[model samples]
Target: MDVARDRGAVAIDRDECKGCGLCVEACPPRVLRLSAELNRYGYHPAEYLGSGCTACGICYYVCPEPGGITVLRRQVA
Candidate 1:
């Protein structure tokens, strides 16, 4: 695998996602997952909890809902 950029702490807004699971499925690295844990929306939004995502923007692009996810920058592999 290529060097995974430590793009700080990425996050997903559970309140925005409809639990469609598109982002999870769309992840090329399969780093996302649909959690049974529901949020304020009462829907299980996708979650990213691993490391070294490569910062490929796959999840960001896949998220149809705007402002659903936030990508940050980090200095670690």
Candidate 2:
């Protein structure tokens, strides 16, 4: 199996997410997806694909909920 190198990371606050797919659509690397499992509010929240994020912040900017998505850029040595 092939895997992408970890370029960045994304944290999605499921509680804050309202199932809006803006982040999923805006993600450049197409790493974001809406989970089938429902959250506490019974909404499908966005989840990271575990890799391929570019730390572009498009997901963070597109997310309607404040603090819903947090992008962390991998530090280069």
Indicate which candidate wins on TM-score. Answer: 2
lDDT of each: 0.74, 0.89
Q: Give the Å error, residue 19, model 2.
A: 0.7
Clashes of each: 2, 0
Give the TM-score comparing model 2 with the true structure, all chains together. Answer: 0.91
lDDT (tens digit, per residue) of candidate 1 on 1-77:
33354454458888888888877777766777888798986988888766656566777887789998877666554
Residue 24 of candidate 1: its Cα lDDT? 77
Compute each candidate's TM-score over C-alphas. Answer: 0.74, 0.91
Q: List the residue pairs that clash in candidate 1.
A: 8-73, 8-74
**Candidate 2 off by > 4 Å:** 1-4
Residue 77 lDDT in model 2?
A: 78
